[model samples]
Target: MPLSIYNTLNRRLEPLRPRDPKRVTFYTCGPTVYDDAHIGNFRSFLAADVLRRFIESPLCELEGSGPGPRSVVHVMNITDVGHMTDDDQADGGGEDKMAVAGRRLLEQKKSGKLPPGVELDPNSPYDIARFYTMRFLDDAKKLGLKVAIEHDKDASLMPRATANVPGMIALIGKLIERGHAYVVGPAGARVVYFHVPSFEGYGALSGNTLDALREGAGGRVGTENQSGKKHPADFLLWKEDSTHIMKWDSPWGAGYPGWHIECSVMSAARLCGSGSVLSPAQLVQMQVPDAQPIIDIHSGGEDNIFPHHECEIAQSCCAFNASHSGPYAGMWFHPRFLFVEGAKMSKSKGNFFTARQLYLPAPEGKGIAPAAIRLELIRTHYRSNANFTEQGLKDSARMVERWRRFMDTAGKGSTSSDAAARGACREAIAAAMHDDLNIAGVLGELNGWLGRVDAPGPEDAELLREIDAVLGVLELEQAKSAQTDIGVFIGCEADPAVLAKLNERVEAKKAKDFARSDAIRNDLAAMGYQIKDVAGGKVEVRRG
Candidate 1:
């Protein structure tokens, strides 16, 4: 079966297609690097990771050609600038989020809360952005979300918003030249706005009419009214202000680009190739040509469906291909929210938690595994809001442990790979994945198959390997060793020192030396070893 997905643009299931049959350009809206990313934010990224895996899998073969690393390019932008708090559509309405975080650090320094030599400048947005960007990427690494990290030559491309400011300025100029944008307000305080009425399909993506969006603007309508906006809903393209330290010199004045422009510009520059040093006439014609789609798929959370994504479509279309009457992205995918304890996560409600918080033991007793976290998130359908609970974590851990044991047992028998066999279980898994990523169904099928296994046959072994290509939660290779630990128990290999202790413990037990054996157990526990007594006067030593 061919791969199909629920495209949010047209609100229907569509067959996957790329402008170039050999390659696919995938773009995902990344996090604003101002704070630690919460679990809710990671949910959307998890969906993107799953989608990329499925797309690159052999099961996604189209006619005869198969998608692979060279065929698919996953681009996730890092919003290190222009993102602001109090912005409904994530456009710059209030203060820059990085600047706000920097101010907090400044306050902390004044209160003497900083570590000795740690100095922070409140005016430097880069300092705050760097701090949280590292945190966010570290969290992504811990959670095993697939993305390019540091200097790794990975499949995904991560471009920063600040790095593409020149491209943003050029795109804004093109918008103004095309009569889709206008400059308003006074000289130094001038702000550029996208004329929403200029684009005929302004609200096509969100299905909100221009007049309806303007009517619902409420207090925000008059907020920019003093800026001389032609319409209440005209979103900001650039804001000219000298007080801001993050300002850049633009045609309009020395100011910063708006929040919506960042995504549009970055994606265009990275994926579609915006000319860096082209003349004004040359730049105007340097839009994404209609020969191929600029982006094959654009993925984000459901919250970005309106104004944020809608604005992207308008800005991209007006700046590049104003005559084209289609959405900027060929397909759109918006994963639903991830609720905690059946409620929307909020710090005020004491339910909001980061991936780091979720990685540790919640109540200080049972620790949550990162693999378990990955499993629980993937078990639910992406379109549905998955409710995260402690019980869910426990269940995932148990299931993962069971699968590991099965693979370990299977590993002892079959050491050969079946080069041409496609097992029934593997086929079912692929079919489920092909059908809009029914990962819940995939898990159900795999779990049911695993439960009936006393020992995996050759087919079962091959199936396990094949399934893991998409579901990367399994640790089969580690489980292959005889003394391999499956879950909380760590495995230990027999060494001279370990054998000496094991023999001593056995001798102590035979001599009815309970005190000596207990002392030995405590000593082993201190050294990260757990001793388990077994049948035939033998003992199992596992690393903790």
Candidate 2:
């Protein structure tokens, strides 16, 4: 079956066929290195990782004769600069995540929770960027995501002082030459603005009406200088103001490229090769073929579809002109927001949990395993609002445990079992994922299959492993760790009452009354211990 993905550009599910079958170029908007990213942010990333793994995984039959497709290149960028501070704020609506973390650290110090002499380097954005970027990478790794930087191409080419600036400037020059971008004056300062209205199919991605587009444009005026714009909707390509961090000489002036511009430039350079940057004026020459490669999939949070993604499409399409076809990306994917309780996760609300906080040992409060947390976050569909809770984590841990037990019983010696099982599991997983990445449906199916596997044969074992590859939560060794000596001790110390309830559940299951067993499980869960019914009728429970 052809892979079907819900393309935001077309507003429907479409078959995924890469322009070049040999290669697939995908770009996801990565975390800006201003502060520690929240778990909510990682959900979008994890979803992308799953897609990447699914696409890249070699297909095999029961015989295991040949390998399937592998990704020629996969590029995910790290935004170390130009992200606004307003998204972190409720009203200001900018991304001031670093500021929020700084405040929390100060509060911890005042309460004597943080040790004395702890300092955040104030003088250097690069230092700050590197610090948080590493933290983000650590968090992503814990979630089982293989996020590789295109170090040899993009990162190696970047200037140390201003990593992405040089490439960004070169891209802006291409856009200006193509006449897709224009310079505008705002209070004696010049800012480069991309001509958004020129693209006839501007609203195709977001499905916004012209009136809605105008309303959104109205808000962009005060936030930045939009005075020289021909229309209110034009977005800045380069900012003239801003000192001390990173700046490159551009056609506009000595300035930094806009946040959205860098991705277009970098993606083209990496995928299509570093040809002379195409500009609006140069686009009129029919002789020069549109040599820049187009992207197959562009993904991010739904919030970006409007100004961020919309502007990217407009500028890229207009600049490439006849060389390019329609939209920059054939398909667009956006995951829904992850919320803590009912509200959006934020530091100011005291509800946000960083990836580090979720995985690393906490001083006092209970913490879930990194794998369990990842399962919980992805349990719901990518398009659905995932409400995070301790119970949810426990539930995920239980499900993971069940799968692990089945795999262990099936054994690992039969290579054919791995291949056959993986094939069937991939079919099931792909069906769920293709349905708008229906992760909830996928997980539900997994639980049902686990319940049915009494003594899993080689087929069942391989299937479980394949599914686990996509789910990223069910390794037999990790499941063994779920009941290790240290794990039990940690559970006992963290929540003894909950542990007692788990023992009661085990007793109920021993009595052979499933109703009582399930009730006991629920009761123990209320207190925060996730119970898994392993093979041989043994029960393993862990503190969530």
Candidate 3:
């Protein structure tokens, strides 16, 4: 049987079918790096990672996502700028998230909780974004996210939003040319709004019609924001914000792109390929209509279904489709919300926990094992609301420890071939996993296998290892150090080689060679290092 998952758009189980059966294009809405990604964010990520791993696993070789060394082209974005402070803001009504992060980081530094040196500029939003981006990646490593493990190996797999503004600008321009978007207000302060009525079925994904949308109106916009919009339902493509720390040069003005726009562009750019959003004039020529959505699969948290994902459908179909052939992706996979201790998990409530806080040693709390954290985040069905609690973590820890001991006894060299038995067992788990990612069923099946008295002989142990690859719950003790990419972590001095690159960049800046300077800066940023210009021809470089 083919792999099937719950498609949120159609509210049904759909077979995993891609444009190219041999190669699948997958995209996930990754975290906005304003602060540490709390466990709720990771819950969604780990669930998606399960799907991704299954797509590339041997279970898929016969009838699923197709099997090869590079069959699934998975891309999870790194959102470092222009995220909304409120989810209702399709037009970026509140302050930019990066701007908020800069201030919040400084406050944390004052509170003596956050990690940043005294010399680090509290005003530099880039510094804060880089600092947290590295931390999030580190947390991901400890949890065994394969994409995070291979982040440095393939630059194309993880595209950063700040690094893709040019593509965003190009996509917005395409919208204007197609009559789906228009600019308003004065030249410098102009805001580009997607003309909602121009696109039919604007609210089909989220179940809000244009009339209802007008009543709800996405967000409570200020007089300034409300003044320029063509219709109440029309959302922002770009906004003019001179004070935003993360503004960029665009056709409309020097400002930030809206929260909704980033996912549409970033997803299309990577999954549909980079040429999908290159240059304004060439966009029409690059991607022709009738090909429908160039992406095969798109996944995110259930909260993203509103103005964010709905707006993505409008803008993406308008910009990338000549006719509305399909949604931006063939299938939409959304995991339900994660609750904490019977309440909605929120930082304001003091229940919010990062993966690090749960797994790494800290004074305020005892740490759980990294493997347990991974298991706790993903053991529940993706379609169900999974409540996070201390008891749940403890339960997860016990299970992980049991598996570790079982593997020690079972995971060893063997001569016997249990290929038929192993294949049958994997088929059972894969069937459950593919049935809307019924993860609980998979674990139940695993537990059943574990109960056998003579279980995990050499061949059975090999099969368990194969199953664990998809589960991603094994071998966390061997996780890479948090500072794998960075030569030196944040709050530490830069090494000699990084210093040399910094000096080279400074020299390039002195010579007014902006392209070279920008290239050097981006190269360093990709290596998890960020630079801040210091006084008198000097620079500060920190990595984490």
Encode model 1's per-residue lDDT on 214-314: one tens digit a residue.
57745355553344777767888888877775778998888788878888776766566422323334445766654345678899999999878998888
Off by over 4 Å in 1: 62-70, 82-93, 106-123, 149-151, 154-156, 214-226, 274-284, 289-292, 322-324, 360-367, 415-422, 457-459, 475-544
lDDT-wise, the better of 1 and 2 is 1
Error of 2 at 7 (Å): 0.7
Tens-digit per-residue lDDT, 1-544, candidate 2: 4556778777778777667654666778777777777888888888887776666655311112223554635556677763442122223655344455555555665678653454555345555667666667666766876554333343422212245566666556666777667777653356877776656767767766455755765444343434467765666778675452555666666656676776665555555543333332332332223533367778888898976787777666665546533668867888889988778887798888877676664343345567787888877777778898867877887777666667677785443333444455557766776566677777777776666555567777766677677677763123223344212433324355655665666666668877987887788778766767655554556556
Question: How well does each candidate superpose onto the true structure, as a TM-score?
Answer: 0.81, 0.75, 0.81
Cα displacement (Å) at residue 29, model 2: 0.5
Q: Which parts of model 2 are misplaced by more than 4 Å?
A: 58-67, 82-120, 148-162, 186-188, 209-212, 215-225, 242-245, 274-293, 321-325, 412-430, 475-544
lDDT of 1: 0.72
* lDDT of every model, 2 decimals: 0.72, 0.63, 0.74
Q: Order the candidates by TM-score, highest first.
A: 1, 3, 2
The candidate 3 region of ten consecutive residues with least summed lDDT is 479-488
For candidate 3, list the clashing residue pairs, or say none: none
Q: Tens-digit lDDT track for model 3 on 1-544?
A: 7788888778888887777766778888898888789889999999889988888777664344445653677788888884543224443455666667778877878888765453456688778778888888998888988878878787667778888778788888888988989998898778888898998868778877776655664445334436667776677788876766778887777888877877777777666654233443444455535745568888889989886788888888888776743577888989988999989987899888877777664333344567888899899888889998889987987888787777777656354335665666678888887677777888888777676525466776767788889888886773222232223223334456676777678678889999999999998889767676644545555443
